[model samples]
Target: MSTLDQDLASQIERLRAEGCEIIRSEKVSGASRDGRGELEIVLQFLRSGDELVVARLDRLGRDTRDVLNIIHECESRGAFVTVLDPHVTTRGEMGHVILTVLGMVAQMERRFIKERQKDGIERAKASGRYLGGKRRIDRHVVRELLAQGQSVAAAARTLGCSRMQIYRIIGEAPPAV
Candidate 1:
């Protein structure tokens, strides 16, 4: 198994040993809830006595508001959430307080990470070691295709880019045709 899969398996085994009966996992980023189908399923399936457990608070979300919203949702449904790493649960008032603090810390940490990354990029650029992202489509090829009388849509299709990119390359607004 891949390293991520192996880590997940180990986490599952630990939770199982901890008496967790139902477990769900997803490899998607926890930055937002936009594409977390497994999390949604668990939230929807929660009952009065059900407990939602995650390996860590960050596993729930990186945004403080999103994490609090999730905890609130679970509480409103009479379900509890547990974080294994810090061993906190919504079974008591203290847990809520601690979770709120932890959520804020996680959000702050994300911001700090972004700041550090920006600083590193600045340093690399100053040293002439950082080039921007690799080019995905050749501007010359796009121009040649358009010069051959291809439609904006057709040129975009041929170059695997957007029609707007083709329009930009040709420096003209889209024709009414």
Candidate 2:
């Protein structure tokens, strides 16, 4: 298994040892709630006295507002949130204060990471070492195929890209087939 997968498994094992009955995990980015179905389910099914545990505050969310919103939602449903790394919980008012500070720190760290990434990209561009992402589909080839009267589906199949991508390259809507 990958390092992240192994780490998640280890965390789950540790939680189980600590008597945590239910666990929710997802491999998606914590940058936003989009595509995080597991988290949604946990929030939806949370009951009074229930606890939402995460390996770290950042694992819950990278954005300060998003993390606070999640914690608020849990609290609104009479559930508590627990972060295992630094060991914070919503069992007391102090926990709320600590979690808010941690959430802000996480959001600041995310911003710093983005800034570092942007600086690195700029340096690479200056050194002529950055070429951006490699083209997955050749627009010329896609255009030629479409000009040859190939259906959008046929072109997509030939190019190993989605029809949406083909349409995007051709700069036209999909013709009804």
Candidate 3:
């Protein structure tokens, strides 16, 4: 088998010996530093029948509600999480308390960061320095693609942009024949 498979096998064996039950699930969504890579990793762990271990709580989830829900679901299934960093585990009362505090702190940090970013953006805009991001595909081109009977998804794929962006441009475009 592949090296990753072998390592996963070893991890499963270790968890079984620790008297821990593992059940993986994929009903989750989140963002990551690499944009869309978090979904892939979460899917991988979910497919492996593993408890989805992480070195820290933030490594497992992005938002407080999402994190708590995942933890609750995992626990309800007789599985437990073992966070290595900050040494938090969601298997007992103290662990639950610590996890709760950490989750709240993470959410607060996210809110603070968002507020700071908004203030910076407003300052930049006031100074006429906020040019926003580059326009990947022109609005006229997006309109033409839609006029050619292309669906939003297809037009976005053709233009190498998001469906939301396609919709935005299309909304600004004049009525297509």
Better of 2 and 3 by TM-score: 2
lDDT of each: 0.89, 0.91, 0.69
Task: For candidate 1, give the lDDT of residue 133.
Answer: 85
Most accurate candidate by TM-score: 2
- The candidate scoring highest on lDDT is 2
lDDT of 2: 0.91
Tens digits of per-residue lDDT for model 3, 1-177:
997567556655654665656433232334232344544455445532345565457656767786787777667656676776687787678988888888888888878988999999999999999999887788878878888999999999998888998878766747557
Model 1 per-residue lDDT at 76: 93
Per residue, candidate 1 scores C-alpha lDDT tens digits across 90-120 of: 9999999999999999999999999999999
Q: Candidate 3: deviation at residue 116, Å?
A: 0.4
Q: Per-residue CA lDDT of candidate 2, range 54-141, in tens?
A: 8889899999899999999999999999999899999999999999999999999999999999999999999999999898987778
Clash numbers, per candidate? 0, 0, 0
